[model samples]
Target: MSKTYDVIVVGARVAGSSLAYWLAREGYEVLLVDRGTFPSDTLSTNNLYSNSLGLLRGMGVLDALLNTNTPIYRRAHINFDGAVIDGLFPESDGITGCLCVRRKYLDQILFENAKAQPGVTAIEGFRVTALIQEDGIITCIEGKRKDGGDDIETYSARLVVGADGRLSKVREWAGSERKIAVPTDFASYAAYVTDFVQEGEMHVEFYKNQDKLAIVFPTSDDQFVVGVMYPLDDSAWMERFKSDPEEGIRRLIDEGFGHTSLADRFRKANFAETVKGMHGYDNDWFVGMGQGWALLGDALSFKDPAVGQGLHDALYGAHMLSEILSQYPASEWKRSWEPMGKVYQSAMEAKLMSRFWIGCQFTKNTPAPPEITAAYSLVGSDRQATETFLGMYNYVKEPEDLQKEIGRLLSGVNPQIPQK
Candidate 1:
C-alpha cells in the first residue's frame, strides 16, 4: 500500500516548511517535498520588516534567528532624489526592529525545524511529476528522484498544497488560470559584501535620476547584502554587469550614491559571494483553491520584489492557511477548507495589489509629485510623520492614511485639536 498522509506539501521553502511546521504542531501528518535541498541559496530581497519578524517569533524560530547574529536594524534612512527621510521603527507586538538574514541560513532553519517535527516527513531532491486525480479531485502525487537512481514514489494524501513558487508546476497541473497578471520592465542584481563598515541602521537609497534603487542591508556574519534595481531597457549595462558583476555593482553604487558612506563601504568591501540576480518580476495571481488542493505563497500569487514583501507574504500566507486547516479534519478538507482558502487567497491578492500600485509609481521615470516631495521634507524633520509614512510598509497604516497626513501637513493644519 502506498503511504498516505493528511497533507502533502510541494516545495519546502518558506511556505511549505512553515505550513508543515504549523500543521505538525497541530498533530497532522504532513509530507513536505522539495526539489532543492536545505541551506541552498535563492534569489531574494531577504530583509524581514518588523511585521514579518513578529510572525517568525510567533512561529518559535525568532530566537534561533536572533542567535545567528543577524544585525537588528532599528531605523531606516531613505533618500529619494536629494530629499532624505529618516524613520525609526515603532515597537509593536514585542518586535522592536527588522532583520536582514540571508535566505540560505533562514530557510535551512525553517526546513530543519519542520523536519524535526513529530508528524512531518520532509523529502528533498525529489520533483513532483504528476498529480493523481480521481473523479475531478486530486488524490495523490507522483514524484521522481532527481538523481534517477531511486524508483518513482507515489504518495496519497487527503489534501495537496503547492508552495512551489512563481513558476509552479502544481498550479499548471491543477489548471489554475491567472486572474491578474502584469509584465515587468526591471531587473535586479545583488551581492554580499564583507569587511564593509557596518551602518548602525538600514539604508534605502533611491536615485530618481534614472529610476535606480539600491538597498544596503546588514546581515549575519558581519556581512552586508547590497542590491540594485534598474530599468531593463538598459540591457547593455545589465549584460555588462552579468559579465563582471562585482565591478558592475560597484560602478552603479558610485554613480548612484556617490562618495557617501554607503558608497564608500561598497568601494572598500570585498565580495563574500558571487553576485546573483533575476529579470522580469511580473506580478501574478491565480485561482488558488480547488477540491482537495490549494496553493500557498508564490505559487498562488507574487508581487514585484521592489517592495521587499515576498518572504514575508510567503511565511504569513502559510501561517494563515495552517490556521484555517487546523479547524477541520483532513477528510472534509475539500468541503470545509476550500471556501476559507478562497477567502485567504482574495485577502493576499488585495494586499499585494496595494503594494504593486505603489511600486509602479516609483518605477516610472518622473519626478515625484510636489505633495510627496513636501511629505518627505516633513518626514525628515518630524518623528511622528516619519513613523506614519514608514508605518505603511508594515501595514500599520494604509496608503490613504499617508495621503491624508501629507495633505494635513501641506495645509498647515495642526493635527492637534484646539483646546476648548
Candidate 2:
C-alpha cells in the first residue's frame, strides 16, 4: 500500500513551492517534492516588479519579503546609440514596484513559508523519474532517492500540477504536446556586486549594441545585481571576462557604449559574485495533455527575459490555477484549465510574443523607420501610454487589450490603419 495525497507537485522551486503552499493552505493533502534542498541556487535576474506586491500581500508573505530585501522604485533606463531614455520606477507607494532579495533568498523564504503550512509534506533530494498511471489516470510517481534507494511513491490526487521548469518531468508525464517551442537564444550573466549599492537602484539599461546590455538591480541585503546579456555563441565572452570578471564588465561597459558616465561607475563597482549564462526561448504552450493534469509556469513554456514577464506569468498562472482547482468540480478540471490556458496564451501572444518581436526589430542597429520610432517614442513619452506600458510591463493588463488600447491611441494620432 502506498500513501496518497490530494495533490502532488514536482519541482519545489518557485512555481512548485508556491502552488504547494496555496494548495496545502486550502486544506488539501499536498505532497511537495524537489530534486534539491531548500535555499538552493537558481539562475535568475534576481529582481521582481511591483506587480508581484499584491500577490505577496495576499499570501501574507509581503512583510516577510520586504523585511528580507530592499525596495526598488526607479524606472528602467534605455541607452541606445548614445541616447538615454529614463522611465519611471515600477511602483508608486503601495502600488509601486519592488525588488526583494535575489532568487536564492526569495526561493528559500517561499520554501520555508510553504513548509510551515499544515498538511504539507515537503520531501527534498527526491528525483522524480516517472509517473504512475492506471487506466489513463495518473496515480503515483516513481523515482530514486538521493541515498541510492529505489522508492516508489503513490499519490492519488484529484489534480496534479506540473510546476517543474523548462525541462519539466510532470509536463512530460502528462503527455502534453508542445504547441509552440523555440530554442533559447539570449543568455544572461548576472552577479552580486557589493559596496556599490545606490538608493532607488535603477532597474534595467539597454545598450544600443546588442552585444552588450547592462542591468543593475537592488537586493534585500543592500547589494546590487549587475547582469549582462549577449550572444552565447561568442567564445570571447569567457576569454574576455574570465581573467577578471570585474574588469571584463568594465571594459564591456566602456566599449559597448560610447563611454557613458554610468558605464564608468559600473566598471569600477565592486562585485561579490560574477556569473554568466544564456537567456533565450519563446512562448511555449503544450497541447493534448489529459484533463486531470495541467502544466503551469515554465513547465508549460517560457519566453525570453527581454520582456521580464516570465516569473510574473508563472505567479499569475499559479494563482489562476488555484482559483480553478478550488472552485470547480474534479470532473470539470479539463474544461476549467482550457479557459485559463486560452487567457494565458493570449496574454503570451499579445504581450510577451508581440513585444519580443517588436523589440527584436528595434534593437537591431539599423535605423528604425520613422513611423516605428514615432510610435515607440509616443508610448515612451505619454503618461497614460506609459501607464499602459507599465501595466503590461508588470503583467497587470493583458497584452492583447493593451495592444488594442495603444493602437486606438496611436490611430487617433496617426490614422489610415488597415483592416483585414
Candidate 3:
C-alpha cells in the first residue's frame, strides 16, 4: 500500500480519464478507477465546442472520436422566436466536427485512451471506500471491487484525486466542502431521439421564446440532443419533472419547440431512451486541492449545464492540472503540495470564474432588451460578430468581455446612443 504514484484518479470518466491521459503523456504514472464498465451512460448534456476539442486532439483521442461517425457541424443557427441568425464557427476539426457525442461513446473513448497509455493503469467496476490518511495528509486510496468480493484494495499515490463527481467520495473522505455555492437560476432536461431530420450540413440550433430556451445538438449514434432550460425562480417545472421526467420534458418540447421546424423533425421521431434531468441543484465549487488530494470535473466545480460547459470545464481543468503537476518531479509532488496548491488555485480561478459568471447570466434567462436583440440582429448580419458571439459561449472569449464591443457596435445603429 505504500507504493506511491504520480497520481491516483478516482471516477474514470471525462475529468478523471482526461487528467490521467494528460499526466501520462507527461511521463507520470497514474491509476484510473471507476465504478462502471465501458460505454455506460451518465447524466450529461455531453457537448464540447472547439476549444475543448483542442484538448482532446492534444491528448490523441480525437482520431477515435472521428470514427464514431458523429455528424460534422460547421455552423450554429439561432432562432430567437421568429428571427433566425446563422454564425460560422471559427475553424475547428476537433470533436470530429460535432458539437456533442453521447457520453456512452465520449467517456468510453477518453477512458480507453487513458488506459492504453504506457504510464497509466485502469480499474473498472471498482468502488472506492476511503482515503488512507497519514498524519492528516492523504497518502493512499482504499476500496474493493464493486462485485461481492470482500477483500479490501488499496492504492497509494502522491496525490489522490476526486474526479469522482459532484457526490464524490474522495471529496467526503478528504473533508472538502462547497466553499462557494450559489442557487442556480434554471432547471434543465434533455433527451436523445432518432429520426431527427438533418438536411444537408448539420447545424447547432438554439431556439429562444418569451422566457424559455431550448437547443438541438447533433450527437453520435444517429441521435439529436434536444433539451430545454426553464427558469428556476419558480419551482413548478422542477416539481413537474420530479413527478414524471419524460412527460415533463416532452411537454416542454411540444410547447416550446413546436412552432419551429423542430416540430416536424420530432414529428416522426421517438425518444431514444428515458429523459435525463438536472433540477434544484446548486451551482457549486470546492477547493481545488488539499493536503494530499485534488478534485476535478464536477467534483471541483459545476456550472449550469444551461451553458453546456460541464464537459469543457472538466477537460480544461484536467489539462491545467497536468501542466501544473509537471512543474515538479513526480517523486517530489508530496512535498510540493503547498506551492502546487497555490498555483492551482490561482490559475484555475482565473480560468473558471469567467465562465462561471457566464453560466450564471445564461441560467438567469432574463429577457433581452431591444438593444440586446438588436445586438443579436447585428451578429446575425455580420460574419465576424457572429463568430465572436459563438465564441462567447465556447469560452474562446468571455461573454462579459464582449459587452464593450457589443455596445460599441450597437452605438452605431441605435439612436438611443448619445453622441459623445
Candidate 4:
C-alpha cells in the first residue's frame, strides 16, 4: 500500500517548502520532496524584496533572517551609456524593505522550518520521477527512495503541487505545452559573481548600454552579483562567454559604457564565485495546473532576472496561496487558485513582461530617450517615486499601474538632472 498525504509537493526548494510549511501548520499531512539535500547550492540572486520579506515575516522566518547579515536595499543606480541616474527607494507600505542573503542559508532556513512543522515530512535527496494520474486528476507522485537503498516509492495525495523549477519534470507530466519564443523577442545570458559592494546604499544597477543591458545587485559582506544580458543570436560572443567567462567578461567590461570607475571596481574586486552561462527561456516561463494540482513560483512563471522580482514573486505567491487555502474549502482549491493566478498573471504582465519588452526595445542602435533617463534618476530623488518603484520591485502591487502613475508624475515636471 502507498502512503497517502493531504498534499504532495515536488521540488522542496523555496516554493515547495513554503507551501508545505503553511499547509502543514494548517493540520494537513504534507510531503515535501527535493532532488537535493539541505544547504545545497542553487543558482539564484538570493535577494528578497520587501514584499517577500513581509510574507516571510508572517511565516515567522523574518526574525531569524534578521539575525543574519542580510543587507537592506534602499536605492537604485541606473546607467545608460555614460549617463548616470540615481534613485532612493522608500520601504513600501506594510513592509520595511528588502534584504539580500545567501541562497544556501535562506533555503536551509526554510527547509528546516518546514521539516520541524508538525505533520510535514520532508524527503530530501529524492528525485520525483513521475506524476500519477487517475480519472484526469493527479493522484500521486512517484520518486526514488535514496535514504538507504535506491527503490521506487510513491506518495499519494488528494492535491499535488508542482513547485518544481523551470524545465520541471512535473510540468511535463502535467502536460504543459513546449515554450516558444515570441517573435523578435530573443533570449539573454547572465552570470552571478559574489564580491565587492556598491557604496552608500543597497541597490540594483541597470546598465543600459547601446547594444547590451546588464543588471548588478549589491548584497551584504561586500559582495555583489552582476548579470549581463545580450541578444541570443550573437552566438559567437555567447559561446566565448560560456567557454571562458573570465576572458569574455573582462573584454566586455573594458568596452563597457565608458564607465571605467565601476568597471575598475569589478576588476580590482575579489571574485567569491562564478555562476556562469545563466540563460532565460522567453516562453514556458510560467505554467500552472487547472485542477487537482497547482503551480507556484518559477514553476508557474519565470521572468528574466533583469527585473530582480523572482524571489519577491515566489514569496508573495506562497502568501496569497496560503490565504486562499485557509479561507476556502479543499474542493474549492482550483477556484481559489484562479484569483491568485490572475493576480500573479497581472503582476508578470506588468513588472517583468513589460520590462522584458522594454529591454528588447532598446537592443537596437536607438538612443535611450531623455525621459527614460530622468525617470530612472527621479526614482532616487523622489521618495514617492522611490516607494512606488520599490513596491513594484517587491511585487506588493501591479507594476503597470505604478508605471502609469509615474508617467503622470513625470509629464508636468522638468528633470532636475541633465541627460548626457
Query: What TM-score does each of the candidates earn?
Result: 0.92, 0.82, 0.90, 0.83
lDDT of 2 by residue, 113-189 (tens): 88889988888888888887766767677766687666555556666778888778888778888876555444456
lDDT of each: 0.80, 0.65, 0.80, 0.68
The per-residue C-alpha lDDT of model 4 at residue 294 equals 72
User: Which sequence of candidate numbers ranks them by TM-score, best first?
Assistant: 1, 3, 4, 2
For 1-420, candidate 1 gives per-residue lDDT tens digits of 279999999999888999999989888999999999878988777888889899888888998999997878877777776677776867766787888888888999999999999999899998899999988889899988788665789999988999999899999998887886776666778888888774654544334434677877778888888788777888777887878978888888888778356677678899999899876566777887787788988888777766777788888788778877777766677676567666767777676668767765654546577766666777677666778878877777778887777776776777676634
In angstroms, the error of model 3 at 301 is 1.1
Instruction: Give the per-residue Cα lDDT of candidate 4 at 390.
Output: 56
Checking candidate 1 for backbone clashes, the offending pairs are none
Instruction: Please give, for residues 1-420, the per-residue lDDT of candidate 4 as tens digits.
Output: 379887888888788889888897778889888888888767676777776787788888988877666677667676766556566545554776567777777888898889999999888888888888877777888788667466788788877888888667777778754442333233344455565546676677777676667677766455776666666677876787778776666667656644645676666655567645554454335445445677777777665556666676667666556655667666565445566455545654454555445434443435668777666665556555666665566545456766765675667554464545
User: With candidate 3 superimposed using the best TM-score fit, by how many Å does residue 87's alpha carbon deviate from the native?
Assistant: 1.2
For candidate 3, give the lDDT. 0.80
Which stretch of 10 consecutive residues in model 4 shows the poorest summed lDDT? 178-187
Superposition error at 408 for model 4 (Å): 4.9
